[model samples]
Target: MAAETKQSCYEGSSVSSFQFYLERSGEHEAILRCVRDVLPREFKRTGADKSSLDVLGVGSGGGQVDVQMLTMLQSTNPGVPITADIVEGSSELSDNFRALVEKTPNLEKIPFAWNIMHSGDYEKAVQAKGNMKKFDFIHMIQMIYYVDDLADTIKFYHSLLKSNGRLMIIVEGEKGGWDTLWKTYQKELCVDAITQYRSSGEVIACAKSLGLKYEELPVPNQFDITDCFDPSSQTGERLLNFMTAKDNFYESLTPEIRSGILDLLRHKCSTEKDGRVMFDSKLSCILIHA
Candidate 1:
């Protein structure tokens, strides 16, 4: 078992790597499509008796996507007061989110409470238990894998939802490079205690165990990983580093381990297309009804 503690991109100056990962993986198109496909219906479900709506965004990195979702919510429920609570652990990302909110039209009108803390810490401080009905909409996108207890986190978030509330969680599906990568080398790749390999399949199982009512939507996505094999390519290096959750992955690992990982990533996690290696970046979106 590899035990050397390493810095995650969340705490390091590797936001660029993360950004590269998103770009290569074609995440925005699918995620933005999800926001458009789901949020309007969720907004329509808002209880007529409620004077205002509350939104909780967990692991809201950079806030671009969150802003898009919130904008949709505002458009759907115009004239109604909407409060958005952003929970992000990275100070840099939270700052980015803050700066983004400033420039986004119609967002400044809504009150935003920025809690720059890990979801685990946020959960610890949460005193409210089941049936709180405190939130109308709650979303944890691309961040559930970092939580200590996914089951408990789901339950807690579900409890915070109102009768008509919805909890939307988006994560890597079992059919993605992330799942394949982690299953093959999780112990070696995971540097922090927060790192986990749980996919949407596990999320479904957890929700089932909790007997929570939910719907699953699979978003087909892929990544152009043709550059990952080129050692001299900076973009490829960034994607590889992001994939391994390590900084300077090539220089840091032993040759045998490095070669083995590359082999696994190239063969098992991706497929050769028309002169390009396309990675399966499929994501699963689970909407839990409260």
Candidate 2:
């Protein structure tokens, strides 16, 4: 994973800011590959020489995935021109995307433009920055949960996509590995409930209602920070820094509960037998095409 300037990372100065994500691009690369492989499925061949292939990368955070996707497309076909629109709400992240793509060799040469938009203002934003009709691929990854009106948003994206073009939504599955980690540490962490979109089922149902073809892709992930537990070790320093930055997560609990939870996490992360900290995380990729 490559690092970027601190100011060009995320939208805000939250504890879990975009800077943390920059160092974890290696982990996220697999998800990008999976999405790329699944996204083209929605597009059906209309003709041989000319097929309008437009890609709308919704909620394109950090722009790392966008660069990777474009690189993949260019590698497959150098002369291909993909009408790519990067629709992102975070101005900081959007700027990062622009900088990264401009610096990347093959990615910079690709014939595509990035149109950044705030995640909240979709309608007017699109009107101001994008074109209507159908897109070849519309990707929304780890972003629908932030949307206040999920169905309406999907409908709007549906309108932007052409026939056989796909609207792909990738989210962390409720029953996936994240839940397992939450369950494992819930009691220990003094968290009664976790926050996430309700379920992947609703995404599928919502897509179906829009008369789009649907497919689900399952992806799993985990963190193994064994080397970092030695206190003097620096192997997984990137992951460790991420964990430290998340200390404010304890703010969700009462003082007493927070203390207890912290102690438990410390134990789990630094015991003699299990000197490694592990978390199970999994995501679901839902692809919808008209």
Candidate 3:
């Protein structure tokens, strides 16, 4: 099937825009930390110790996640070198990624390489010619939902992993803020995100169907850094507002419905028993070997 141009464009832009959000949430750090915590044990047991450790980050643009991942890797093992092969889909974002990495300390110490591979066409890169081929870990965060064929795409990733290597996918869970907002105003939210709503469950099930043993890591709301929205901060204002705006119920909404969404978020952020805006979310890491 041909790639969804409009959706792909939206995703490319969204991933670029989300670079700022990832930095702000310290989510980049949290994820890398999790990888470090589990990777060594997993690798040692799987006999990846002698093998050169390489990481392939799909949808890795602007090196936002790269900085965090590399920083965490260095802290854990300064002598241990990592080969970070980043496959970014957008040329513009890929350039930005290169610039960002240049400023990170000792990033050069590790082998950080990247290419412009449209995420949807990532299979081509994995199958490309080279000794730096395959990977110990292939990571995708908040990006898999855009693929037209989740099962085929995931299976492809599974095929690229070095023996006992892991294919990790981190997505907003079924009960996440993404889903909660959509559920609250499904009619509005569904307008623009119907595909996302429809495919969220299927992606998880797709992995299970393949017999990919996985771990569902719950990262939860964890966005406890502020109150109200700070327009200057990426996640604080843009993300919060985007979630409220994308409610197809909110977008397709008349002025009245738009106003209702605003009012609800306001109330939820204020008087709700959770004391904080309650948004349910989870992240999963699916491990496999080729």
Candidate 4:
């Protein structure tokens, strides 16, 4: 559906609403699995020397995924101290993440330094402080959409990596259902004020163009969106908002546009089996080696 003027839907979204969206859409589970699968390949200890690792978590929301990764890293290198620089914009998310760290016993093993700022802001602050801190591992988990220049941001983060360090990026695959839907309707559905939709395919191409050393891995995932068919369901409506990045997506769209989107979701984006709708919500993990 087309609007006379486009607007950002996420401006009014609350932390709880976003969390609910993640939990209901099966995104949380998929991300956790992706992190687990990708960590061992890069975070494992080498030889007998215990290594002290510095990690930079870009746009690490609420620290759920960060905590998991840190736990894995700590387990991989026992007794090795870890310094985590968590970069996040939202105060609510940062506070929630700190609270989680205080409560979780496993997270206690790793000492953390919370950089309560956006990635760019943190970089600027570090530069101002004349600190040349390099990271052993840096992860940007589905957070590049908020960045102004994805390629430049990638290059800057890559430069922050130490020798043999890994910069892991997790985003939706180009041919996945979310990517297809976002690409098709982005012009009409996305907020004009924000950057258009981005996928792992574009990031990989950027890495190749930059001549960066990288490897791509497919992360199998699916979201059961059967509840989205019910227009009156609040969960369904919120899920739609999350998917389209539009506030009240069902309500905002024109009848024809809404129908078209629904048709695409039913036939192309998802498959119906055993009376349930499952979207091929696969993710891509790009490991850029320094």
- For model 2, the run of ten residues with the poorest summed lDDT: 1-10
Clashes of 2: 6
Estimate candidate 1's alpha-carbon lDDT, on a 0 to 1 scale: 0.80
C-alpha lDDT of all candidate models, in order:
0.80, 0.57, 0.59, 0.77
Tens-digit lDDT track of model 2 for 87-162: 6655666777788888888665455555555554656666687665467677887667556566887888877766
* Candidate 3 TM-score to native: 0.71
Model 3 lDDT tens row, 1-290: 01122233325556544554564455666556666676656555534354356778877655666677657655555466678888666666677778887888888776766666666555754457444377777877666655667788888878778876777776655655455555677766545423444224656688789887666655534454243334256445555544543313323558776666555555443234455543333444444445
Q: Kindly report which residue stretches of model 4 are placed more than 4 angstroms away from their true locations once superposed.
A: 1-13, 45-51
Q: lDDT ranking from best to worst?
A: 1, 4, 3, 2
User: For every candidate structure, what is the RMSD over all alpha carbons to the true structure, in angstroms?
Assistant: 3.5, 5.9, 5.3, 3.9
Evaluate model 4: give its lDDT.
0.77
The candidate maximizing lDDT is 1
In model 1, which runs have C-alpha deviations exceeding 4 angstroms?
Answer: 1-12, 47-49, 128-133
Over 207-233, each residue of candidate 4 has an lDDT whose tens digit, in order, gives 999999999988878878887789888
TM-score for each candidate, following the candidate numbering: 0.92, 0.70, 0.71, 0.90
Which scores greater on lDDT, model 1 or model 4? 1
